[model samples]
Target: MKFADYYEIMQTIARYGHALDAGTAPFDQIFTDNVELDLTHAGPPGQPGPVIKGRQHVLEAMTGSADDPHTYRSVLTRPALSHHTTNSEIVADRGDEVEVRSKFLRLGNSQPGPMPILIGQYLDTLIRTIDGWRISRREVISHGP
Candidate 1:
């Protein structure tokens, strides 16, 4: 793939981080309409999380609505900083389709401590659309503290 394409993909990942930190609902822009989000590996030990289908479902999970009681609004509103570092490697680049394996480190400083709250890796599948490159599938693998 061209460097521009690579940079664009990287930017998309960066945007994902920004949205999460800001608690903004940018799912529709970042992911495809029928995106598949697999967070099973990120679940607690002995329990597997369900694979979420559709952009709307993923958006709700990421940014809960005002009417949702179990949303992560409290956490997102904290006076903390979140950083998402991605080391992405392009596995395949077939013109309109791209697959990337990215090692991600998500750090959150919500308290007066020098530690992170979450860390994970993402296996992403992206497709080039009329708007731009959007993620179609993302498999999250968690590495806990």
Candidate 2:
């Protein structure tokens, strides 16, 4: 991959957290039309999480709607909540497609101090589009709640 491609890919990954935190995630910029978000391992321990499909559904899940209550809007709207990413590695690059593995940390500050709410790794498959690199699939593996 070219240097510019690598940088753009990293920026796209970082944008996910920033947009979500801002509550103005541009789903089209971050994900493909048929995106698959596998949160099967992102829920509380011993519970089966959801595997959201399609960009529109993903938007509803993240932003919430009157008809859809299973959303991350609650946690995202928390004043003290923030998302951080580190250790991004491009595991594969085939010009038009790439795979990235990265670590994510969710933190919350309240009362006395800030604390980690969740730690996990993101396995993402991104495809090049006319707009730029967009994630086609994202499988989140949680290490802790």
Best by the TM-score measure = 2
Clashes of each: 0, 0
In order of appearance, the predictions have TM-scores of 0.84, 0.89
Q: Please give the CA lDDT of all the candidate structures.
A: 0.76, 0.85
For 66-122, candidate 1 gives per-residue lDDT tens digits of 344232453443456575757788899899889988877666564567467667789
Winning candidate number (lDDT): 2
Query: What TM-score should be assigned to candidate 1?
Result: 0.84
Itemize residue pairs with steric clashes in candidate 1: none
* Candidate 2: stretches off by over 4 Å: 66-75
Candidate 1, which segments miss by more than 4 Å at Cα? 66-77, 110-112
| Candidate 2 minimal-lDDT segment of 10 residues | 66-75
| lDDT (10s digit) by residue, model 2, range 70-99 | 224643658878899899999988889999
Worst 10 residues of 1 by lDDT: 66-75
